[model samples]
Structure formats: structure tokens, C-alpha cells
Target: MSDFLTPKATPETAPFWAGAAEGVLRIQQCDACGRHYFYPRRFCRYCHSTDVRWTTVSGRARLDSYTINHRPLRGTESLSPVIALVQLEEGPRMLTNIVGVEPDPANLVLDMPLTVDFEPRGDMTVPVFRPASTGSAEGTR
Candidate 1:
């Protein structure tokens, strides 16, 4: 077990974490409905079919929403991470941390183009996002 706090992986979520460890973003796509979804599951949220398969994604996303934490959680007093929901390019939204930028509302614009980055925590790797290096800030509301 790792000293770092992390979500316990169920069988369904293992592939996601495995892909993260390899620096790849992974999600599930429903073969039946042609919709992509996050938080690995046995069935598709759209079609309710068991035909979902793990797929690698571009790791590019848009910041759908976020909140900056000035207060640190217990045992993590030295770090303040930005909690955010990002809409993946493949159209799935997932909870993640926003990194490589000031954790302020003025800097964390909604719909900002973002790219994935990973941090190793004990036995697991966590995916985080940052503003895309080459994109304009315009319309990133």
C-alpha cells in the first residue's frame, strides 16, 4: 500500500490506472452506441450495453469546471492541488487535478484547452491536466 492517498482500483478501473502508469490516457468507448465514457465500468452509460472496451485517448481535453483549494487536506498540508472536471477530446468527462498553472480563478478558465500529465503516487499514477502550451486563451471561457 502507498502512503499517498489514492482511489482503490476495482477490476474495472485497473486498465485506466495501468494506462496512466504508462503515461497514456485511457477510457471506455461503447461499441453499440459509439459513445465514449469515463470511470471505467462494465456497461455503457448511453446504450447500457456490455460492449464497452478500453481505448487510449489523445489526452487532450477542455476544462469544463474547476476549483482551487487554498486549504490543504490532512497529511497533504504542503501541497494544494486544483480539483477539476475536464471533458476529454473523446467526449468523456473525468475528475482530475489541474497542474502546471497558478491555481487561481483568473488563470483557470473554463473550456481552456488542456493536455494530460501524470504524477506517481506510491503504487499508482494519477493523471492531471495543464493548459495547452500552444493554444490561445480566447474563448476558453
Candidate 2:
């Protein structure tokens, strides 16, 4: 009875979802062009070759941009989400949610270092970001 949206894993995205379910972040890398990409595709976006493979990423990133969503969709009103664009350490930018901190502008700073965290939605685990330096005696930078 969850209200969150769950992604349907396809042949091209099954590995990525499987990794996520196991608490790992996976991205598609183009074997031909040596470039990495997100949102799994059947072919390499850069080289136009069917040479893409799933690789586990470091789960580290920088907060590129974000918005605090106060207006929620139907059945999601209880959650005030922080939607964000994060640039992964491996060179791909992904649209994800920021968690483990306040959703206000005062807390969500640009270029803040982040680490991935997963939240279960239906049968899938969705990736979300958190302040990388959180939980340390020294606060996040």
C-alpha cells in the first residue's frame, strides 16, 4: 500500500535494478566509447553501439541542483520531498531525491558532497542521496 512510484525493470535495466536491490549503485557504461550514462538504454548513447554494460559506481556525487517540493502528488501528500540533480563521481548526472536532511534551501546547498542511500518502493529499491559527511562528529561540509 505504498504511494511511491516504482520503476518497471526491462531487459536493459534489470541489472541496474538488481544492483540497487542489493544496495549498490549501478550505471551503464559504453564499452566502445568509454563513456558512462544513466537511465539504462539498449545502445550506447555516445557511440551508438550495442556495447553497454552495467557497472557498480562509487555512490558518491555532488549536488548539482534541486528543488523542495512542497506540493505533493495524489497519495504522496505526507512527504515533502527534495528533488535533485546529482553528478555522479563517474561522470553521469542523474535525477534523484535527496534524503537524510531537511528539504529546505538552507540545508540543500549546491555542490554539496553526497552519497547514495536506497529506499524500498514496492519491489524495487530507489536510489537517493544524503550528505556524504553526515553522522560524523564533524558536520557536513
Each prediction's Cα lDDT score?
Answer: 0.82, 0.83
| TM-scores vs. true structure, each candidate | 0.89, 0.88
Per-residue lDDT tens digits of candidate 1, residues 1-141? 337676667899999998888888889999999999987889998889998899988888999988877777676653437899999888989888888888778998899889888876667887888888885443122
**In terms of TM-score, how similar is model 1 to the real structure?**
0.89
Which candidate should be chosen as best, given lDDT against the real structure?
2
- The pairs that clash in candidate 2 are none
Instruction: Give the number of colliding residue pairs in candidate 2.
Output: 0
Instruction: Give candidate 1 regions above 4 Å deviation.
Output: 1-4, 78-80, 135-141
CA error at residue 66 for candidate 1, angstroms: 0.8
**Global fold similarity of model 2 (TM-score):** 0.88
